[model samples]
Target: MNQLLWMAVGAGAVLSIEGLYWLYWRYVGSGSVRDYINEDQEPEGDYRILRKIKTPNQRIALVEYRGQMWIYGNGDVMFSTTEDENMYAEAMVHIPMAAAGKRNKVLIIGGGGGVTTREALRYSEVEEITAVDVDDVMLEFGKHLEAMVRFNRGSLNHPKVRTVIEDGRTFIENTPMKWDVIVIDVPEPTGRYPRLSRLFSVEFYRLLKERLEPEGAINIACSTSFWMPEYFWSIQETLKKAGFQVLPFHHFVPEDGEDWAFCLATTSPVDTDGLRMLVSTEYLTPERLKDMFYMPFYFANGQNQGDIQTDDNTVLLDIVSEADYEQDGNRKEYN
Candidate 1:
């Protein structure tokens, strides 16, 4: 009987080890399901390849991962359909438009899918919108994808919307004219690409600050509240150090299973009151604006909680460490 009990204990230990190995391989080692799939060869509607298109410049794919449409360019998944893409586009574009008080001559830095351009045109007061996106294939795929096209119907073909195929950083550096409103809709910095990392740097925000009109606002998609607290704070701090009054806001995206944050920094305060006045088709009301500022204790406490910022160094790394601790604690409790 003792021999049998010992044998059972040994088998249980082996099974436990195997279970841990599988969990690690599934979550961290293999990366997310959205990241691993090669959209080029994946057949459409096969629980993969939501849609695929190849343009002259690059290959783009749209896949339904995590219950939202994700745009992949040159094998890199760019923006996902977070929140209602329409609601997000409307809030980002219209808030700044109303704040600017003049809609003519706008510059959209990264809205390749044309959602922002569509919302910008809704006012009818805006004369021209120059949209600069690095991925040309994304535009092509979006045009062909019925649901995507429907999101911004007729806006891509609108006479006022001129699509400029170029890098956003290069466009900003070389463009001669100043913009009334500059909507920066770039992806979060994952350290995957050096150019993406540069967007979060102090120098880059300074360049963006220089290009803006005295009252013009820059709206950037910040990182998720869950995965990267350090990244979000670093971005906010970098913008603040670059000399803009920063206002941070978040919107919940059910499909992404995360609350996405956005930072609006400008020489002038963003007209939250003016934004409240807009005839919103969605639910971005004054109360909602207030709610966006409310962060949970875990996220709020993790911000500068256990970090020391010196003159020579930034607290980005420390903030990330605290966030990780909180995330792991929550995971353990739930599991």
Candidate 2:
């Protein structure tokens, strides 16, 4: 009788926990969870979960939301969406690619989804492209998973592309090989991300400069310019302190309905005034590309408000601890 009572208590606890989860799921938006749980929930309206993967480094999910498929990292980090990925990808990849005159041997750091690689492959001059990510599983998904394969268009498996599973900063530090263009398509260091925050430091960019060819350039995805103005400027300032000529620009992602900014950094002299695309683009033309440099009125004014980000003094990490991004009454939710 006692044993039966204990079993009943355990079962009750389980049921109660599940009930709470159900309530949270019902109330909140699609989760950005750290736990390895594939939420294969039933299709609610236009939202459905397609896949979930657990890597030693990160939790990944592929969900179909609002007639578009989206990939989320750690439940919150929306890596890419089928909706306007091309617009963001083109803006991220093309500027730096155009800056690099040789356009051969490009290195894409942290874009395991392969969207950036897909854009880089557009240039016929690209002889060898290396795509590196910390999560090997995500790269496998991009290379093999049917939905990801379709989305990335098998760019990971191209003969000209080589996939490496490694930390982006470590790879840059160790490799003797120099690249014509290096695309930093990693997540923004907005939260308490120790590892990721390190990547934004002056130290990392200086090391990256060493790996870049004299005529080469790099493009880093500096989170939303409007939402986190200070952080955005900090990244640009950080790059400048690292001894690179920084050209800050932004483009809108329709799915998120927010302005995502990017920076083109190079030690080489860049003629930002006469920038043009060497390859044809689906979304970004040369005219639009040049115009991206025009900053929002308020955002332009705060360009000098940033402190240089460093490994020891992580201003970028400290500025984004949930409370800072609380605009109006809406809580900060990157997903």
Candidate 3:
């Protein structure tokens, strides 16, 4: 019996050591997914990775899915869609722009693919489009890549457009130019991406309020209210605390596999009665704009008990990290 017990203990120790090593080798030792897969061979079954870009900040992958191209940052699909409709981009820029009425100088933060800038240029009133992003690699992709340039209507290279490779918040802090329409198209306030969540904080919004024209309006991509409601409303509350009258709205994005929320904030009244498009678009209409503003009961009351995000408090990260959300495209279970 003693000998049998010794053998059992020895076996368990060996198995545990082997399991730990396997984990390290698979995750830590392996540099990235690109390192494991052969570049020449199609490794993701239905989806094929065309190119992978390594920046100091993140790993970017240009993927081809069902004959369509998608840009993914750190395993998540970017908000910009390749489709002509580009519902997300149109909705984010136009409604607030229409409200502002005479927006000449527009500021876009985190315009990764230049799609947001593309939508902004549709307004004939917009004279200058300043796109600021921390990732120069992404900016270069927007400037030169055939697929990205095609979808973005060559907005990055447009004479009226200027691309700045700097942290959005830092640029805003230093720039003397007060913008007419400010569009915040950043990633979700999750831990995977660093420093960006700070953009959603009250202090940061206050900085935005400082740079914004009195009559100017701001729009933000507020992540998924369908799954992570707490994170959504906390951001809504943070914006309000920053001294702006806020209007929270949402739309279903097929790429994200959920309903994504957005906040339209203004120093003045949000009177979009005169909303009209200066250029042609496939998706956004007056009727649809009315529907987009409708928030359901669950989404309206999402912030049950949470403090506003602050520079020192770190509340948003705690909430975002604890939330259980599913992004369909991020996993092997893409449908």
User: Who wins the lDDT comparison?
Assistant: 2
Please identify model 2 stretches exceeding 4 Å from their true place.
Answer: 1-21, 24-46, 190-192, 253-256, 301-303, 322-325, 328-335
| Candidate 2, 1-335: lDDT as tens digits | 99999999999999999988876765554543334222422234656667777666666777777756566665454455454677878888988988886798899988788888988998888899999998887787779877778878899999999999998988888889999999998776644345788789999999999999988999998776365667777888899899998888888656556787888899867887778888888777667776688887645634277888887886877666543446535754331
Candidate 1: tens digits of C-alpha lDDT, residues 1-335: 99999999999999999999887764456533334343332324635555556565445667775556677754554555554566677667765666664667788887778788877877766888888887776665445556667667756668888888887878877876787788888754332333455555676678888888777877777656555555666677778778888777777766646576777777877655446535555756678766766665434534432322232443554444455466646632210
- Overall lDDT per candidate, in order of appearance: 0.65, 0.77, 0.75
Clashes of 1: 0
- Which candidate should be chosen as best, given TM-score against the real structure? 2
User: Candidate 1: lDDT over CA atoms?
Assistant: 0.65
Those runs of model 1 whose alpha carbons end farther than 4 Å from true positions after fitting are 1-46, 50-59, 64-69, 73-83, 253-257, 270-275, 298-335
Task: For each candidate, give its TM-score against the true structure.
Answer: 0.71, 0.83, 0.81
Q: Which residue pairs in model 1 clash with each other?
A: none
Tens digits of lDDT, candidate 3, 209-251: 9888878989988876365677777888888889988888877
Count the clashes in each prediction. 0, 3, 0
User: How well does candidate 1 match the true structure, expressed as C-alpha RMSD?
Assistant: 8.2
Model 3 stretches astray by more than 4 angstroms: 1-45, 79-81, 253-257, 272-278, 302-306, 325-335
